[model samples]
Target: MIAVALVTGTLLFSPVLATHQVEVRGTAVLSTEEVIEAAQVPLGVPLTRLPRATISERISALAPVADVRFGQSLPHTLIITVTERTMVYQVADRGSFHWVDGEGVDFHQTAEQADGLLGVLDISNERLLRDVATVVTSLGPEVVTMTTKVTADSIDHIVLTLSDGRQINWGSAEKSAEKAAVLPTLLGMKAAWIDVSVPSHPAIK
Candidate 1:
């Protein structure tokens, strides 16, 4: 009992286990300095006294942060691993748009258009927004590169417009992988419209 109490007291009070360095990892668009600034971890504070939950909340408030995890590296370091959000497509909102990730999280907002991502137009509510995100993000690289815009009047009426002014009737978010797999072959044809809502039997016009 005495030994355990001594060890606990030493960890809580001594500078030997205090954090002197913060190591940031797994960042893409976020800089290490910005992550450190957001963490606000007090230097020379005992690791046992660290407010991990508060630190996580602060770092997560950053627009690009999807998830954050912390670890104590013994002696003098606090390690933070950050997972940044991926901008799958842009959802239009008047003059600007919000960026959505694969799981349908709207994480960032910007007025300027981004490269290599489709712009979603005519989106109404959160449900349809998530549905559109699912359909577009499930597409293979070949189909995604050719797509310029995605629009959905209703969940069942999702459509994709290619760069060459042609259209693809994507139906719903169901069977997205199959639909994406079949689009490249269908794109070779000079059809004005291609329907892969049911990939087993496609339609063209």
Candidate 2:
């Protein structure tokens, strides 16, 4: 009888301990404010109402939010978890800088520190964004950091600038997976630009 009474007491007390709490935790690749603003979830909504899948879907609408995970902390408390997309290039729209993700979505930054990012200019279309993102995503982390900007003349052809002022010519997005697979080997080469448009036969200019 005593043990059963204690167990019931714990369950009842558990709700009192963690009720009415909500936390939003996420990496702000574009900006935290954007994520919160875009979600537009109602304040004080119960954790149960904050459907995990629904919230994730809504959050994904934001270009910078690559992935999101949400859960309930207590009856009334909810926890939001998010993974932000990496900033591949900052497209100069007009005069201001807007961060573009692999999907080619534009986002506003909340801090001035983002100014030092690699500036990708002369892009006025959506097709170029996907093309650039394809190349940026294929390359490994080390190679991505070396990239400064990617300008696309056509969907298949793109030019990438490196930190050392070198240029890279990427042919077509068709063979992007194959082209990206060989990037690790190409990283060792020292040239003005490494062309991965043709993985079987690459031309260094």
Candidate 3:
């Protein structure tokens, strides 16, 4: 009975189990204070009683956080690890531009244009954005650096405009690996336009 009481007392009031520190990791664009504020972690609470799900839900509400992980550093600290989303594409909307990640989530808007991101023209549909993302991600680094913009009026009519005034009819996002494999060879040809939508029957003009 005495041991049971001691255990209960320790569980309820032990300073060793209280959270005294918070460590945020993997933050680049987001500040530590921002993550902490979003998490709203209950400091001084017992580490075991910390509501991890609630903390995660709060942090996940932040636009830049793609994923997050939580851990308790025994005796006094809580650790938050974050994976931020990559800004892969930019789409013009209402005179401002919005940045989208590979997951097709439009996370932020900027007044100034960002360099080195694929400019998506005439597209606002989320599904089409996802398809564009798939195509962009599938390209090799060599091809990606030469490309400037992507446009798709419909899922079946995707196009890539290169920096050097060349065009590629990339069709739908399907069979991307096959398309990517044949693109370099097509680029080597003396053509103004290359069509690899049906990679099985590539055409050059």
Candidate 4:
């Protein structure tokens, strides 16, 4: 009876543990004010009673947030951590370019092109964009530095153009991890083209 009473007392009267401040971290593209606005954190609510999942869901609804986590600091503080999506490719539309993340989400648009970002030509299909992003992101840093552009007529017809005018027939997004693993060795050879479409039996010319 005494334990139950003590628990009830804590739940009912813990004003000192009520949330009074919110701190946001791990943000790069998003401002702390934007995250705080999106989170809609309930100030004055007891930290123990705050709906963590609900807060996370609200923050995740923001376009740039790829992932989010929530925590409570003792007494009166709420902590929010966020992981923003990275721009992997850019699609040109009517002379303007939009940034796309690895998940194929076009989250931002700009008139100026970013250095080292690959351009996606003519393809607007989201699935194809995702496939292109997958292949581009899976490549080793060395291979990525050599890549200049990615293009596709269809989902299965993905191609990568290297800085030295070499071409890579990446096939579909399937088996990308395997292809990425083997591509570096193939690039070392004196070949104008490399096809890792079928990673197990890659071809070079």
Query: In lDDT terms, which candidate is top?
Result: 3
Collision pairs in model 1: none
Model 3 poorest ten-residue lDDT run:
115-124
Question: For model 1, how does the per-residue alpha-carbon lDDT over 1-205 read when each residue is reduced to its tens digit?
Answer: 9999999898777999989999999997789999999999999898878899999999999989989998878889999999999988888787777887887777777788778566565544777778888888888877788888888888788899989999999998888889888888899998999999999999899
TM-score of each: 0.80, 0.67, 0.86, 0.84
Judge candidate 4 against the unseen true structure and give its global Cα lDDT, from 0 to 1: 0.86
Supply every candidate's count of residue pairs whose N, Cα or C atoms clash at under 3 angstroms.
0, 1, 0, 0
Cα error, candidate 3, residue 110 (Å): 2.3
- Show where candidate 3 strays beyond 4 Å: 1-13, 72-75
Pairs clashing in candidate 2?
156-171
Full ranking by lDDT: 3, 1, 4, 2
Question: What would the TM-score be for candidate 2 when compared with the true structure?
Answer: 0.67
Residue 145 in model 3: shift from native, Å?
0.9
Instruction: Assess each prediction's global lDDT (C-alpha) against the native.
Output: 0.86, 0.67, 0.87, 0.86
Candidate 4: tens digits of C-alpha lDDT, residues 1-205: 9999998788645897889999999997789999999889889989878888988999998888999988868879899999998888888878788788988887767788876656665646778878888888898888888888888777788889999999999988899999999898998999999999999999999
Give the 10-residue window scoring lowest on summed lDDT in candidate 2. 110-119
Q: Please list the Cα RMSD from the true structure of every candidate, rounded to 1 decimal place.
A: 3.2, 4.9, 2.9, 2.7
TM-score ranking, best first = 3, 4, 1, 2
96: Cα error in model 2, Å? 2.2
